[model samples]
Target: MSVFNQPRRRIVVLIILGLAMVLIARLSYLQIVEKKYQRLADANAVTKKIVYPSRGIIFDRKNRSILGNDILYDLVVTPAAVKNIDTSYLCEILEINKEEFIKRIGDAVKRNGRVRPSVFAGLLSAATFSRLQESMYLFQAGFELVQRPIRSYPYKAAANILGYIGEISPGMLKTDKYSDYQSGDYIGLTGLEKTYEDVLMGQRGTRYIIKDNLNRPQGALENGDFDTAAIAGKNLRLSLDIELQVLGEELMRNKIGSIVAIDPSTGGILAMVSGPVFDPNLLTGSSRTKNVSKLFVDPTEPFLNRGIQATYQPGSAMKPLTAIVALDEGLITPDFGFPCHGGYTSCKFIKCLHSEAGHAANLRAAMAHSCNSYFLHLYRMEVDDRKWGGVKKGHAKWKEYMSRFGLGHRLGIDIPGESPGIVADTTVLNKRYNGNWNSCSELYVGIGQGQVAVTPLQMANAMCLIANKGSYFLPHLVESIDLDSSDLLKKFKERHTVAKISDTAYHSVIYGMEDVIEHGTGRGAQMNGIAVCGKTGTAQNRGIVNGKAVDLKDHSVFVAFAPRDNPKIAIAVIVENAGTGATFAVPIANLMMEKYLRDTLPLSKQPIMKRMLETTTIQLSKLETSKIDSLNATTGMLTSEAILKKYFH
Candidate 1:
């Protein structure tokens, strides 16, 4: 009793006060600051049903719905609600054994806990749904059929452009970026679907329902005051022409390459096709898992969008650009000439198509005939200009001009997985030549070989620049998104101008391109009434096997723009392993141009369309090595020799 002094009593009282403050502060945080515990506490009594909004409909240029939505039924289960019922009957309905049924239940419980509902079986077929619908009342205690909306392609066109969607993966669920997403949520995995997901996927709503101790629904919680209505996703209107897309796919059928067409003025994509054409329907519904696994192992890689993803040496198609760069740099004039006798005399290995003297008398004639020597000489002169100091500096300057033309990089197209095709800078050139290179060392680039590589999309965009005389809009897929005020399309709307070349120089280039379709190598691309400016390219894509050059088929390529003055459409076509550009690419391009310009093919051109549809340049040996050949076989895609004979003969 004597030890209990006043100062000691005051100290004990202060300690008690501090302890009370900490307890109060922590309690406030749990009750007022933390929302997760509150939701969990609410889950004990209130069942929150998520109201999923309908995904946006994707429309083509003509307001035709290419991509829409369809309903799929999923079998969902609540482990806590599972009760005394015919377990054997349920297993029979699901076509699963006892072990599988137990394992699935355990998986569902472990995934989302016993109190919450989880998907036991997803993407149920119509037949299964019909069979289960009649007896759903029997299993009402634990199981329910929930309607899930899925992407549907009505025309079955633009598989690579529209892309596919799937359930969110487990790994994505734990991240803060995806904390809003739940286990059963779906997300766009690629293409325009993934690029505009935020606009395409609308706000999700919630409905609170009161439940009994047995987890059976009692009634709406608080007379549905807590309920929020779902907001449907915004619609997407694209610049794509559905009919053009269909025609492109048909023309490109059985081939391994791409076709890209764009509107020169607006830079809107008209059509983009990556062949062999894959059915978008296969990547949706219950068959998606199996089809995806098949596609994953396919050697041909149908999943790759060749229009933007695959790169190639542009060949002679790059000559016009070479000339434009040289002219713009004041290194050459429109009338400048280079004498040729079968090849470039300086670079003896680089051959020319014309052996006649004075074939390269002028720029227009040289380009029309695709004179290798003239363009090569032009590239060397431009890069080795005295103003640029040396080859390295000149090359860097040349590269800068190329970038302005939208080469050597992605054009920021609306789709994902677009490759920034190789445009060798000094660093790459140094590495390739061990810092001992000169303009002559990379002169083959003038002919679009060597260090230059470009995608079909890039080529098409370059065509747009040429058609517009060194200006272009960013190539874009979506034209507008409903209710969008964020100016997502501002970048595409701005005009980008490159190069300060004179109008006379443009005239020479345009005139040369006109000659190409008129009477040159690209004559097959000619249209009777329209002024079609085009260039043909036969690009080498080979390898060194056993330290020796391996002989392989060259890729056929063509780039063109139509009606020359105030040009409307710009296009690029590539056919892997095809012979000459005139053989496959030029004809396909001509057909596309005629269709777009005239809006109908003349009766005389019917035979050309027929022949194109029946052709297959893809070697059968290559097809046999892929899972696509076997998988496509199931869908009446004839991969056998009979098809080859039928098409070729």
Candidate 2:
């Protein structure tokens, strides 16, 4: 115990006191100065409500609103706050029984905890909402009404294209893909709705409301300091011409097929029509679920979007593609002719459709006449050409060319559910023919038959390629998103070149197509002033029926691009179970072109339009007969008589 020890003890005591004072100062600052803890305590008395943003509207190319929004009311309930409210009176207002009311309350409690609000009845009608609004005050803090937005379609056309929004499923709620979504949220189920879902579904906001002791919202919490404003979704402008869509749908009534038209300039879809389509309004509002069930079970499959989903052998409509390939490979000149004795010498499976003398002709004449033997010979020569090492190598090169044309792969269209048409490669051929196959083994591909299958979209796109002479933009439905940021559509705006072939090769093929409409198999598609370059196809059909292989009627197909020089529209039309390509499909294409280009049909053409509108190839029952007799009486041999003679003869 010296004097220095005493000084050290005093210093230690002073340091301890200073540390204690600092701790007290920090506690005082935290308790009085900061509002974090105060907000935490207030959270117990506040309710956070999610504010759903309104979905964007959809407009056609003409700026017409095709889809719009409608206000709907939902009855919500908090099971814990519910008291001795007149159960019978509430049920009467809601159009439900007392037992059903109890069950709904129990369900709400099970779905969301007792203190949370849950939907009791959703998408209430205007009359029901009005009735409930009068009695809403009597329900007290337990029941409340919330406003929601629902979709409405004014045009009632393009149901398959516009698609429908549906409630989120339990599985979707669990998946990471829908992590942002909660229960009771609506999501796009198919078509363009599903494609642009993220952009169309805007950011959801939150609002904090002060709750009283009875759990009723008193007012905005903290004067709305913590509330975030909801953002409306971005709008979408489509390339679809609603008027043309309506006309195409009308022309395809009572038929089973599809038609797709694209603008050759920008590759924007003008019209996409699938037959047996229902009014788009049927799949909206309160009756959506019921109508969906009916459409699901319908034998005709009205839900199918045949334009990009269904695949078929394109028939002679593929001749133009073959002609281009042949001319590009230096395999034949535009004037190269092939002799045909009514059928191909290498293979007897395909027969010439033209006269024997006419079958011995050049590419343009062969295309004009749709001579099957000519194209079959061209396919064999290209595959057997000695420049490529072998048939396998040559087939691979051919597949590469087809893939460039956007075949054998998805075209990356904005819409969902697009099927990549089949183009046989070396491996596919080897597997199908057991590696011993030769050029003749897959010769049917030359005429766009056998293993080759294509969607109506692919056929139209192939025509687009020919129309543009080699390059094309990706076919797209949505033209622009939002107001000024078309940069979001960079993917579709990029130009894609399928073939590097010379323009001369394209000219040869294009001239052949022009001749097809001028006086060939596709003469039915000819217009007076518009020069339509086209090709007709009658695909052989074989399918399993009643557990046996049967020969069904050929599929009628036609592909064309108008004004041969500066093409505006490229189109493909298909009619299933129809007799010939020149019968039902060509006339439909002719009318579609006339409507789109001229914007009106001439008086002389009204009778032809009437005849087309009246024809029904559906054949719902064997006892039901087609209106081909009526078509024959009005449109002469071009429609029914000549097609029937060619098929049965």
Candidate 3:
């Protein structure tokens, strides 16, 4: 029994010895083989570091210039390692206020993890960085520069079109919908920036590094093996000519309206100008807070992209659609006639513009004369007359025809924030009047008055459809996106047909428009050797001219494409409160067309861009109603007696 117990004790001692050996081997492995854990044990002696890759550049499609930048700089701060940092002297060197210096360092302590460094300030330009780099010892331990990029826009005036960038909002960050974006990242706020954000923003790259006890990066401990190389954003070649765009903006200075031009075949925007355009540069860098706020509060609404955002009554521009509908409905032949014996009075209170006398006219002659009576007659015959089928058939048919031509809905342009022009539906009318829908509603819609509204872009797009013989591409600002070997132009190269009107019907409409610019209302747009085709529209408004409600003025509007056949460009011009379309809008449209077509023509011969500019300046200067000492001399009409009775009574 003693011998057995001795063996058991020996066996137990041997087992204890084996267990001790295994424990020693495990400790050796953890200390030697797993050096990472050993190093982490002495966390106070080492620091973990991350390297941010340089951002990519954004270039214009033409390769003419750089539109964005990946500017890099150092952001310095003190950490646990920098125990002897002279807070007062450091503040002096960094040019920060004493209280700010204390608060920033406190924030760094809260945000920084253990020995991790924090960025107190950033974006030191190269020159300042060079001067500071020589005095590195002054900052000591925790001082370091973390490289990062700044958002940039090279073309300053193109802010409305190019848009500005800002930090991603808290709401945007919380959603996680944009998987690519992280916290404290810049995002496109408006314009092309917002429209093509996904394409512009590339993947971010990161690198790991080891730091010394002083928090200075010792080396690329991982040598960028895990880093992603930043990819440059694809270049966007816009259809806009920089020179023409600048000239267009200068032309529309101080005015309240928009100028829209497009390539008739492709719907490539040539120039889109709105008056009082703010400089996009104002929204960049550290200065944006003050400037952007003032701009936002300004009464002029400088931020509004009037070209595709604002809608107005098309006025006589809708005449083309009206005529097309009338012809298609078989309500009238090309020679359909209506006598405007002054004006068409439907009721005591409702009267057409031609109330004085009527003119003998067919469709062609009616368009030439802008005969309101003729359109009113067509609306009554084709729409209001129950014999032809009343509201539902007429309204539905009109809507179908307009929709086919891409009205009443977003034209689906590549740009963001596009406004779908207002189309008065019978349902909307029924809801509004509780089924008291009468000839009154149909009549106003026929004449492009009342609730019918269209953006300048929609109007220009419609005109381009007409100019292209009833087919069009969606209006797109970006002509192509080329990055690496990928050419995105081919994807957008497909021709989209907006409508399919017959060749004969198209020709008939084209001839009428051609006549408008030549022997009719749009004579203001005619130029030598340029067979311009266009129409004029005047949207009437009732407002307080002085202290009384009166017919204030008409918005002048023009839609035209030049050289008639094989048209190069089409344009729509609208000048708010400018009395006549032919007088105000046509001249501007003519100028734009002339400049675009004859851009290479000798400076002396390039009268179009210049004339367009001068005319806009002259018109805007005349907006001051108080300057009109003798209103009757220019207006040739007195205030309505009803207005006087309403106020002076």
Candidate 4:
């Protein structure tokens, strides 16, 4: 009886020991080795906040702040944590009605689940933030304040050049280009802001904090061991001269036009003015969406970066390239003379403005007078030369020369939305004229009319080529990024050779341009002491009027470089529907040159400045209506008949 009872007792003791070991192992796994339960516990008791980095600042060539940073506050909401609070009182603090409060809560829920935070009201003023912060504790666990960096324009100028930032769209978030971005991140939408977004957008950081049972942050988790500090974006220095830019804008105000000024030495833009531009601050803060909507539908098209995006026929402003091409090809000498009988002999549609009897002229005289007949002769020589065999080959050669000059191409500017313009290559000419075009058929291109078009930027760059005597750097807005940045900005530092024209040819052409400002068509552009080499152009365009195609008055265009030799600035100015380059564009170009080269206008030119500022080329009614017919009909038709008669008659 004793032996059998001993064996059963040993077995029972063994089974109890095995069950005890299993229970100990399960408790150890849950308490120490497994992290899922601990993670779940932390999720309910910790808050992770994203820290946004400050955007980079922008400075002008003179080190003046063109764009700066300002601190703004956002009202953030966590829908799930909202409890029994005074909803009406909170809405009153936010200055929003009950309906808006409900809608924002719903939106916050839709954007991010109820547990996550979303922006309820963005870009609040300091006064409003102070009022709301005073009452913030009443809405604890449901509402909080987040600081955001917003752009501030101190000079209130260069809106088109600096651009604006806005929230990234849902479409952008889906694309590979913006893969690093999230739903509420801001991105540059245009101009330099868009081009240098990578360098300007600094690295964001994150911080973790312990929360209490009420879901309120108590303190940093683990003494801030997991917290990461935000890295501020790199600063940028621009090539623009803010004073010159301001002056250009003032002069071009109340007009529909653009002005582009470049440093021929560096190809860095000095001043770029697109008229009818709005205050850049309009696109910032609480009113941004509303203001953008207003601008989007505005008839004047203030959003268009006309300096780079708007294309015009370029008028006689294109003749300098023609002269250079002819001289470079050795088809014509500076001394080569053409007898102008008020028009091209082969093309009566092209008229000469110099004289009814016509001037027997050399290249310099033709350029000074902007003689259509003479340039027509030169254009024909370049495209119909016997050495090239035929119009097709000669035209191809001419097209090649144009391409080298940065015409009919993007020119690879750092800014976005630059137009290549119309070069009327062999393919385009074939399409337009059904392969029946010849040198004479496209002779209108010789005078900067017909299908040949250019932007103010391209025109200014062409003048840079002439000022540098056949070589140029690609035009760019940014001068330098911070030293630590790894960006593609170094690409702009390279030089480009447009042509191999002789110095002698340049001298001859320059002499003609000098005469142009001194005593010829561009005489209005003359400064008291500076010698400005300039050319005037009247580009022809057509528009529909009263449901019929009508001839619009030509666009006024002028291009120049001064003090002629060792030129400091190369510029192009275009005034739409403004008759004669001398009337509108020349004076503005002269004023801008004076302001930049001399730093101030002479007392004698004060009257001219006043007159320029007061002149209004755009009619208010037409701009307000924004109808296509109204825009087309009012443009180029606003020039006084007296001015038209003086130029055309």
Candidate 5:
């Protein structure tokens, strides 16, 4: 002290004070501001259990539970905590060898760090769970049974619309959409489950318990003061009619197509059925892995939701739209006549079913008869009109009308992976024909052929607008969520108008469709005491086999709206390779409409329903035989023909 100068002494004292202050500040930050350290400290002395709440329940329009959840147990393990224990006893219970146990433990440590827990085995059978529950004390903290909810379908229908849930992938865990989810968590992969996942997924909670030196739970920490209780997920209410759904599935049992029926008044989907559907229960429980593997490999593609996924040429079903567009454009009147000599001669020689004197005498007659020549001439005249300037411009104008009618684009239904069927415009035409194409070059489009294609959803939605006389609500599945109308429900409730077409033009089209069911080609759809308006379609297309075009059977299609005055239901049906629309599509659609309107089919129609149930139109290619066999062998599914005999015959 005596050797030190006064200024140097002051500087040294200040440095000591500064160091003391910094040390105090860091100590305060660690002790008061940071909780991770406290959590880690508690982790060493306490047991943390994740509490999973029950997933949301899905109900139909009648307040019936369509999709529900059941409790399942999974064997979980923590590698770091797996200390001195009877490894062989655990192996015996799990039915595994010592080598497999070592390998699985190593895999668990590698997948996640030694400190974190992992799923050693999942979806334990009830018998295994019961056996393990009685002797869980032996495994203590390292191994535990975790309770989770798995989906259960009460009716075993609407598999396509409901979709399935799967584990979160490593890639998905990194994304912000799934940031809240962790490894081994489940998420909806498709359909309504995917659409309403945010509302359907339950919140997770944590329970902390004090533990002894042996990692055995003593009691709740601080009398459960810091523990949060698990809250069950919100439930969802749908507009789907479960009874109608069951019927539709039965009717479409042996076919390879889809049917969609909508309440035109509210735009609520009544029934959406895709054939070759599997029981949704197959995707849950212990057999889930094997069933999912088999389903993913099946040749018929039961996973494909044909209602909104499959696209087909509208065929004669599009004649009414052509008539409406032409009438709106002032190109044709209600009484406009055409002298079609069994074919269209102006451009392509497309044959017509009706060549009588007055068959094409007016819009109603032409549409009633599904006269191809009449609609083709209408398209040519509308496209070649000077008002649109040129063929390209005229064609673009026609496409605009088609777009307004929800053609050539997605109608925005509440589902995933929807297809916008083909609707060619000027740009597409120019690219295909090098800008030298004229209206006559694509005349087949007028008859809903050539470049025109549509989904069963779109076809049904179009019928909705036509049924409303000008406007329609967007077709949707969910009606409300937990008795509350969400923004999605609000959007579906809004009515959208297609165009400013006169009501008279719609009446003309409606009259023709009515005649189709009453006395024209769609007479098979006739019903007593009901004014049904319908149209038939036989779509021609070629399939590809080894890069060659093969002549495939024509697709049968039908579109209809029943009780014509105040329309109740609008429906569209398609049966692939089923020949004439009157043969397959008409009967199915009419029966569906009858069920929706009358709540049941009469005794007389029972025979017709049986015929539809036992019939099959699926023609598997040689290339798909092996794949189909593999699926049948591995999945225990019946053959395409045998499925009908097993369930209905």
Candidate 6:
């Protein structure tokens, strides 16, 4: 009792009181001043949301439509919010059975988080959605409809050129790089869609919105300040002219091959048609999934872009290029002719054809008559000459010419599956022959028979270069890009230069090419008042003969550009198994050119030609039979009656 009454005891009591007062004041500040922080935690826990943006448009050069816009609807589900989802009732509303409903819901639950929503089904029609909307509220986890822009092809041709968009794959979804895409997201699967995916598919937009207790969107979060507007995909105005494309497609109706047209000045792809084309609408909107599956499973490949993918030996078409190389290398002059004794001589093999009458004259006549013997002589003499150095040097120089003409390499065109054709390296030849390769080993290459191969696109572009007198543009389908709100694509339509040749060389080559249409194998492609310049090719292809290989058929090819004095359009046509260039390929090219320039062309006398392109479904049937017969010797399936109509009707 005496110690408590002392001055030290009184001071300790005062310090304890001050500490207790401070603790009480801090507790009051936390409960009253920081209470708003707790509301944010509650808001985040219950909110559920997603944003979808409009897809981009695809257009023709004039912004007239190639692939534009169409309606696409999807059925989406949120598993956590899906309560009271009367299985039988909901299924009936959505036109699905109970089993399907369960499967969809189960998939969504497994694939996505419990609170997050996922697409249950895709490509729904508007009529189906109307019925679904009536009882959609009954689904415990709510279902909603999202309208998306599906790809549409207005011209309905060019399916392989425009390509298609498809759903994202599960494997792709698993990759960290694809985190931006959901299961329902569409991707460019082929053609230009795949080639220019980045430019065509714009950046996705995003928005935030507050949700109520039921997880429904209340309104724009924070008054719309937190939204990202989706940038619409750039509209691709392809260099393709719709009218020209339609004419080409119509001309190739019953044929099994490809036609490619380019502008001499711009490398713009005016027309591209692969025969037996399935409708682009078949790959768009509601029909896309079912039709694409059918197309994929069909034996005949309607999806293959034959213009750039199919490699064919240039054949007689290579004659002009060979002549050019010879002239450029100073191996031959206009009058310094070679005697085509109907063949060429080599130590390893003697190369000759069925032709006994070879042109014994200048380069001009050899090209005019398409004399193979002339090319054989020139190749042997030039390659073996030491003036331009050794055989390797000659071959390299020849390769350079090929490259200049966009051969033995992939032309930078905007298409998928484009092959670089086939060019052999010296080392490769040396290895194959055990270090004893000769000029004679590659002798056939001079005539485009050995290892030289080119695509129809390359052939057309090469012709354009010659027509333009030595310069070319990078061949392109999309001539321009258009934004949604502007008429600014004009700036993008400028020409893109690829190469330039000398004027003298260009004019000389043009003269020889002009002679081809005037009095040569390519005479069939000549049009009235068009001044067409052209070259013809008949390439031997393999076939089965008495249990052995034989060159039983030929690929007919024709390359030309119209209005020889001032070329406007250049075209290449290839008809598979068509026997001769003049018979099949040249005629088609002529018809197309006339339709483009003069608008008056006659129809083919062959009944098969008339019927091959009756309708997409029917034509595809014939193509299927042809493909099946090509692949299997044992399959005894006859051509479909629908296809037989072409021959018998």
Most lDDT-accurate candidate: 1
lDDT of 1 by residue, 1-649 (tens): 5434678887888899999999999989989886445644676677777778899999999999999999998899988878886789888888889899999899999888897889998998888888889888778777888888899887777999999989888898989977888888888999998998888888898878777776667888768777898898899999999988877887887799999999999999999999888778888887789999888777778899999999999999999899999888888899998888888878566778898877899999898889999999998998898988898999999899889999998899999999999889999999998999888889999889989999999999999989998899999999999888988899999999997788899989999999998988888887887899999999897867689989688999999999899898999999999978998999999988888888877666666777777777877875777665455555554333443343334
lDDT tens string, model 5, 1-649? 5524678887898899999999999889889986545644777777777887777898998999999999999898999999888888888888889999999889888767798888887889898888889989999859889997899988877888988887778898889989898877888888888988888887888888788888887888767766888877889888899888877887776578899999999999999999766778788887788888877777778788999999999898888888878888888889898998788877757788867788888889888888888899999988999998998889999999899888899888888989999899988888888888998888899988988889999999889878888788888998888744457568888889876678887899999999999888799888899999989999886899789999788999999998899999999999989898999999989888877788767777766776887787777562254243344344354444563444334
Q: What clash pairs does model 4 have?
A: 577-636
Candidate rank order under TM-score: 5, 1, 4, 2, 6, 3
Across 534-599, the per-residue lDDT of candidate 3 in tens digits comes to: 888987766665689997678889998877889998888988777789766887776667768876
Model 3 residue 27 lDDT?
A: 96
**Clashes in predicted model 4:** 1
After superposition, which runs of candidate 1 have C-alpha atoms over 4 Å from their true positions? 1-46, 210-219, 543-549, 625-649
Q: Which scores greater on TM-score, model 4 or model 5?
A: 5
Q: Summarize candidate 6's per-residue lDDT along 1-649 as a digit string, tens digits.
A: 7755988987888788889999888778767775433433554433434455455676666567767777767888877667655778666656788888888889888878666668887877777777776766665356777666687766667888888888878898999967878766787878888876767777776655566766566677556555667777776777887767765665565456789988787778888888655567777666567666666665556667788888888888877777666676676776645555555544443444434443536666677767677777677776677875777776776667678778888887877788888766566677777868777787777777877788899889888777766657778887666544454333334443333445565565677778889987788777666788888888878766689988756888888899988888899998877777887788778766776676444444234234333423223445655432332212222234532343235
Per-model lDDT: 0.87, 0.81, 0.68, 0.84, 0.84, 0.70
Clash pairs, model 5 backbone: none
Model 4 residue 187 lDDT?
Answer: 85
User: What TM-score would you give candidate 6 relative to the actual structure?
Assistant: 0.82
| TM-scores of all candidate predictions against the true structure | 0.90, 0.89, 0.79, 0.89, 0.91, 0.82
Candidate 4, 1-649: lDDT as tens digits: 6543798887888899999999999989988986445644677777778788988999999988899888898888889888887899988877889999999999888877898888898889778899888988887767889888999887777989999999888788889999988766788998888988988999999878778887677888767777899988888899999989877877776688899999999999999999865667777887789777877887778888899999998877888899999999999887888877776667556667766443546888787777878888889999999999989999999989989999988988788998888888898888989999788888878878887889999999999999999989999988898765554777788889977878989987888889888988888888877789998888776888789999887788999999888999999999887888888999999988988998877766766766776777775665556533233232222233332232224
Task: Give candidate 3 regions above 4 Å deviation.
Answer: 1-63, 70-96, 101-137, 140-143, 151-155, 222-226, 346-360, 385-388, 484-499, 542-551, 600-649
Clash pairs of candidate 2? none
TM-score of 3: 0.79
Q: Which run of 10 residues does model 4 get worst, by summed lDDT?
A: 629-638
Please say which candidate is ahead in TM-score: 3 or 4.
4
lDDT agreement of model 6 with the native: 0.70
